[model samples]
Target: MKAGYVALVGRPNVGKSTLLNHLIGQKISITSRRPQTTRHRIHGIKTTEAGQAVFVDTPGIHASQKRAMNRYLNRTAGTALLDVDVIVWIVDRPVWLAEDDLVLERIQTSAAPVILVINKVDRLEDKAALLPFLESAQQRHPFAALIPASALRGHNLDALEHKIMELLPEGEPIFDQDQLTDRSLRFLAAEIIREKLIRSLGQEVPHALSVEIEQYQTEGKLTRIAALIWVEREGQKAIVIGQQGEVLKKVGERARQDLERLTEGKVFLQLWVKVKENWSDDERALRSLGYAE
Candidate 1:
């Protein structure tokens, strides 16, 4: 059996998380239109009759290291490239960007074979342009394979998966065949709350805020959860709560619905917004808030 780790690395908002979810046929990772939606390295395991692929979904590697959070994200993504059997580099568009160069530099150090995936090809207006773009990409690196796919529309993903499995080294499955992911229920609950907040709020607030589950308890068929939303400033907190607490209420309702579906039980969710004074940039604050490596 061909079983190994496949690191999905890319620039921000390039559909790496989307690709991982589609490959596993499950939503173990949260996705948003916002760049840097995935802040941690998550393992999504897919076991088939052929073998098992432990897909590592990582945060996007970007050029900006201006903020401590940005550096942390780059570090998180870069670390995922180590000792992997295969690396799948996903890009949204055909052409390369400056940020793509940043991702290229990090992956070049890896000894594993790299497969270039040009994602979002369904949105491309000129279908014929793909050939020239693929040729240009080949000149940049000796990719094991180049596949044009759309993670959103599920286009050409089977071919991509087939190629990945072929390149993986032969070994026994690293995780149990019945397992889908390597994250705890509490971690996923926090991610769900954070995803709801990101989808509901405007562009500015998503990056400045983080969700922490203060309490989680299960009683028979019901699960009670209390989550704290931390923002960098009071203004952000006010925006998250909204006028008459409507925003927080809506976020809670949406998050609870998803939590129920995930846990297969009724959820009692409580949400509160608080100011943490630039927690995203403070190293100590980040570690305390569960950003530790």
Candidate 2:
């Protein structure tokens, strides 16, 4: 059987997390419309009769390196290129950015074959434009394959999966067939809370926010979790907490709903907003918050 690791590398907001979730038929990684939503290397394992594909969903590669968190995310995404059987380089429909070129340069150094995926084809009003774009992309590098797909609409994804499986090296399945992801429940719980915050809060709040699970316990059929939301300043904390704690309460409710759906059990979630004083720029603080590479 064919089995191997596939690294999904692309610039921010390219729908890498969305593709991974759809491919595995589950949500192994959290996603938001905001850039830099994914900060960790999440493994989503898909085992079919043909083979097992271990997909590594990484943080978006970007040009920003102002903070320790930015550097860590780049390092994590860059490191994922190594020791992989194939690389799926996703990009927005028919458009390439300077950041895409930067990501391409990094992927070129890797020995694995790369597949260029033109994601969000559903947004393409002119289907004829795809050919010229693909030709131009081909002129840039020798890609293993080029596919126009929509991760949101489930368009051509099976074809993409088939191509990935074909490129994967032959081997036995590394993970069990029933396994969907490598992340723990606690980690997913924290990510869910962060996602709620990102969706509910203002644009600037997402960059300043991080979630830490303080305590997790199971009582009979219920899972109780306490999470700490870290912000860079007192003002950010106040913004997150909102008037009469309404914002925090809404975030908690949304997170608990998602956590219940994910765990398939009742969840009792508690959230607290705390100031970390520019933790994103502080290496020690970032490490303490689990940003170490």
Candidate 3:
């Protein structure tokens, strides 16, 4: 049996979360069009006849290190590469960015074999452009395998999985066969609420916001959850609440639907917007909000 950990690392908005979900055949990680949507390192386990592959979905590595939150994200992404059996470096575009250079430098330190996955090939207008990009990538390092895949459209992913299984070391399954992820239901619920907030609000609000589940109780087939949405200031709170609390209402409704689907049971969700006074820049506030390094 081939069983080991696989780390997915890339810049923000490179479809790392989407790739992980498709690879595992379940939604273990939340995804969004916005960059840096994933702050925590999530584990998605895929067990097949060949072996069990535990995929680590990490926050995107970027150039920004100004805020305490940004530093925490970088640290989270960096730490996942330290002890993985294989690394799948995903990139959305054909051309490499300066942030990709930073990710490459980090990967150079890892002894595990790296597979360069070019994701979102379904959006590429010119098919011919990929060849040159692949050629240039090969000159940089001897990648274990270079595969062009679209995680959203389910293209070339089976081949990617085959390569991953081949690369993993021979061992017994680390997790139970039926398990899909390592995250708790409460943590996933909080992540779902945060995803709705990021999708509903403007670009600026997402960076200033964080979600925390203040209370969670499961009674029979129904779950009662109360969550707090932390914003940096009163004005941001007002924006999140919208006119007559429309924005918050919409976010709650979306989150509830997703929560029900994820939990496969009845859900009673309550969300409140509160001011936390620049939590992103404050180290203590960040730790209180679960951004500890």
Candidate 4:
């Protein structure tokens, strides 16, 4: 009856969200090649024959010019580190260790039985070439269990699950079977919209963009949601909107399709782009956007 929490910590876009979704057997978190796709702490609960595993999916750790936001996110990430039964440090399979990778080395030594989950192994066609990367990762931290897996393709995930179960403390299920994720429907809706915008626009825009739900109501057979997508500059807004509203329309349609599936009803999604003029610097805006401590 082993049950406990496992914190998935890593640099941006190392497949932390994807690996969490895979472990939970559901899309509890969104995935994107773009870094910092996950802005908040999302809990994904997994119920198996043995026990339950609650995976805390957090924002990626990176160097931030915004020192306050960086400190906030870092503190949040560090908070998840405390009192967890295990820490799964996700790393990219193709790339070896770097100077920035030392952050994990310094922060993770205090964690109990830190496990290294080398993700995106599917990208490497040659398994032999991955050995060096794996070896280099092992040297960085004394991981309890080191496993190479592809979160997108579910490769070697069974091995990952078995190892995780073996490492967790024994107990009963913490969350109910009916509960899958900790996020509310509105929060997910906003994140879905943000995911679409990030994917469509690519790296032209910064990650300081955030979504806020303005109005949410249910009308018989449909959901009415009005949301605002806040960005830093007018140029970024134009990139998100595309030429002659085509890009914005595409983003909205894509978000709408997913929302319909999630809500199992008609979805009316209204997304408006607004420039908040140094929203990152404003502590109130940061807190409102769920980025604050």
Task: List candidate 3 stretches off by more than 4 Å.
Answer: none
Q: After best superposition, candidate 1 residue 211: deviation in angstroms?
A: 0.5
Question: After superposing candidate 2, which stretches have Cα over 4 Å from the reference?
Answer: none
- The TM-scores of all predictions, comma-separated, are 0.99, 0.99, 0.99, 0.92
Residue-level lDDT tens digits of model 2 in 150-227: 998899999999999999999999999899988899999989999989999888989999999999999877999999
How many residue pairs clash in model 4? 0
Report lDDT per candidate: 0.94, 0.93, 0.94, 0.81
Clashing pairs in 1: none
**RMSD to the hidden true structure, all candidates:** 0.7, 0.8, 0.8, 2.0
lDDT of 4 by residue, 218-264 (tens): 89879999989899888888887789999889989999999998899
Candidate 2 Cα deviation (angstroms), residue 281: 0.4
Candidate 1: residue 259 Cα off by (Å): 0.5
**Candidate 2 structure, TM-score to reference:** 0.99
